[model samples]
Target: MATTPLRVYGGVTGSDRQAERRALFIESGLELLGSPDGEAALTVRGVCRQAGLANRYFYESFTDRDELATAVYDHVVNEIATTALDAVAVVQEPERKVRTGLARIVRLIADDPRRGRLLFSPFLSGTPLVHRRTESTRLFTQLLGTQARQVYGMQGSTRLELLSGFLVGGLAQTLTTWLDGELDATEPEVVEWCAEIFLATSEFPQQPGRTSIHVPDGSEP
Candidate 1:
């Protein structure tokens, strides 16, 4: 097949320029949405101004603010998830793996308070962010349950589902309060506490006749 070479404008390929603009929009979206008044600052005009791009460019990558918001949220989750997995992969001991991953996630949020607000803000209204958060929780629970089986040699069961949901939902709630300054703990304190609970929950013994129990769709990895 004869393939056409990509056309470039001003020395930038079309797709490259689009991706660059999309990246700008997402970064600006993060800035606005991660702010204390993120919800109000998320309009198309606001995002365009924040990104220093034209309004048309905003529409170029995102049909609307809600779409852009989800894009930003997905970017944030993928970044943290990738780093956490990488951190865990490097440690040999299970405790060390848990601690290392927790430290990375906690430190990431600590370093960028905006990330924390975007990911775990309790004040979020009935927005796409809330809906997406629920979906992300489900996805995370699936991954966690799968990992528990691999790391702790546990079978898929209601016990695993319960613990996974508890850990994911509990951590999100705690981080939300902590980010709001309602929790008086330091970053290390929070990470250590979570790591302890994570280990404890993962290592809990299974009850008889419950090891084969399973959640519905989205429960399996």
Candidate 2:
């Protein structure tokens, strides 16, 4: 009989084990970075200890704490983007589309307040997170621009880009404040207000077979 190659328990391969360890480290980073205590607690040794893994495993996955923090921020932002896009895609009515997307974003923070802290906390200033946040904002602005063209046949303009940037930035600050308990509104209220803002600012032209468009100048036909 031929001798079988030795394998780890449960036949887990080295690549699988490494991936598992990397996920553990990412989760640990999220816990540390997203907590109210903030990134000060996100040291490599601290994250490895939290994941119950040794420092060697952490190094195997991330070059340093900054890399790990960037990874965590990217992971959370990707999730939010996916969720909001999915929610918006299933709706055709303008108000419903806006409400669905905005509600998904709000629910993400409400479901895990830590994510809000991680994404929007002031503590993220002067770190790799700032770059990641900028990238995320650009991505979301593009998505909003695309949605505007699709839903309302609106052409891209400098003013539209500025408006989208403003909306994304304002929404981020609003959620950060609400998550930090500075805003006393309920989750539904937050979602509704955000939806209203999106609709009001869009200033889309009114047409048949379309939902009501609120023109800021009372120019709706």
Candidate 3:
């Protein structure tokens, strides 16, 4: 009779387990931070409870509640950026591209209003998330500048950067207002208005003679 060898079940490795725990913490943070109750619900213990994770697991992945909050904020912003870019990439017409991208943003917020509140709510002011919001705006401004160059042949200029920042700031405020019930417009209307603003900015004349108006150094006109 031959002796059969016993098989060992080597389950998940330590690294794999840690990754799982980190992901759980991130998702839990998102829920707590994005809740209608807002950042008040985002304590470390609260997140661990939400994730059904031990406090030790939370510390293993994040230094503190602020770090986890930042991670959650970045996750949501990344999703918004990717979804908008992917929607625009498939279109050739400039108008359609703008419309598609803006519509995706509006629809995403509509689908999950929690994300809108998390990203844009004034209630998050003075929180670590305020820095994250500024970072997100900077990232979107860069994206807008790139899109202007690619779709409109508009080169980098001081004016273009200023306009990009202005548009990004305006858009953030508009969406925030809509999310907070301060704006009465429906989702489609909001999308259309944003697309119009974006297209108008993109169509600005870039002729050197026209746009190169002289300005005194370090002086505002």
Alpha carbon lDDT of each predicted model: 0.86, 0.87, 0.86
Q: Please estimate how well model 2 matches the true structure, expressed as its whole-model Cα lDDT.
A: 0.87
lDDT for each residue of candidate 3 in 1-221, tens digit (9 for 90 to 100) = 99654343377666678888899998888787778777889999899899998899898779988898888888899999999999999999989988998898888988888788888877777467888898999999999889888988889988889989999899889998888899999888998988888898876776435456676787665
The runs of at least 3 residues in candidate 2 whose Cα sits more than 4 Å from the true structure, single-residue gaps closed, are 1-8, 204-221
Lowest summed lDDT window (length 10), candidate 2: 202-211
TM-score of each: 0.87, 0.86, 0.85
Q: State each candidate's clash count.
A: 0, 0, 0
User: Highest TM-score among the candidates is held by which one?
Assistant: 1
- Put the candidates in TM-score order, highest first: 1, 2, 3
Prediction RMSDs, each to the true structure:
8.2, 7.0, 7.2
Model 2, C-alpha of 2: deviation from truth (Å): 25
Q: What's the alpha carbon RMSD for model 1? A: 8.2
**Winner on lDDT (1 vs 2):** 2
Q: Output the number of the lDDT-best candidate.
A: 2
